[model samples]
Target: MHSGLPNGEHALIVHQAGDLSNSCANVGPIMAPDKKFNVSAIFGNIKVDGTKNATIDREIDWPKDISLIGRSLVIHKLSVMEWSLRNKDILPLACGTIGFASP
Candidate 1:
């Protein structure tokens, strides 16, 4: 993790001076009713901590018969999804808000 960033959030690699962007997460089942996951017939929570100290907190609410885990998700500081495409020079992830939020 970055030397200046808070500990125990994202999976960051610590270097001699600080941290870089080679981080990840388990994206596993969590404790809460986050209705955003679309799975968990009962509401569940999926809290994503990203670079720049940005966080995506939501609830997963689905019908009792249906369950959906995050097959696909994006870690971005973007206010909108299309922001990724707007950048032709910078990689979407790089230009995403995470850069500013990350240490």
Candidate 2:
């Protein structure tokens, strides 16, 4: 997927959103059936500019045991504003889902 975040550091995390709960609610740093964001499913971090098109081509190393076929890939906002008075929640900028490639 191409980079949608502004010129800064951002991470792509896989959230379990194809079940009873929503993806944003079940957040985590590891892969699980009911967990939110899976760190193990992270493609990686990327730097992008909001003004220009900085397309990112990510390669997925699928887990043989975990089925993230319909999971959500969420882009998180990470910056130096953590020390500020703003809310410390890791806000999700965007979301995408894993799907089968058409022939």
Candidate 3:
């Protein structure tokens, strides 16, 4: 069981050309999924949506534009979720996610 991004899925390189980073730097609105632009650098907000909650790393700096609408969201898993819940902060909610109170 190999984990991590599978083949054909390239990591987003903020410093290079690819997608999801250019428009963010032009001081314009970016709705596309891929491109090179410092999104948070200009826009200031990012939003995502999805049916199942996903696991996300806390070290990543989210795009900041304030116009996040209609996109898939990722949430942390059990062990990670517990760490978040134990701390003082609202856990991020993904699309179509169902959460139960801890026992």
Please name the candidate that would achieve the greatest lDDT relative to the true structure: 2
Q: Tell me the spans in candidate 1 whose CA falls farther than 4 Å from its real position.
A: 1-51, 81-103
Q: lDDT score, residue 68, model 2? A: 77
Best by TM-score: 2
lDDT of 3: 0.28
Q: Estimate the TM-score of every prediction.
A: 0.24, 0.57, 0.20
Of candidates 3 and 1, the better by lDDT: 3
Ranking by lDDT: 2, 3, 1
lDDT of 2: 0.57
lDDT of 3 by residue, 1-103 (tens): 1133222211121221122233223212213534554542121112122422223222445555432333322221223334334542322221221123569
Better of 2 and 3 by TM-score: 2
Please rank every candidate by TM-score, starting with the best: 2, 1, 3
For model 2, the run of ten residues with the poorest summed lDDT? 79-88
Alpha-carbon local distance difference test for all models: 0.27, 0.57, 0.28
Candidate 2 residue pairs in clash (backbone atoms < 3 Å): 26-36, 27-36, 27-37, 28-37, 29-39
Query: What lDDT does candidate 3 reach at residue 77?
Result: 23
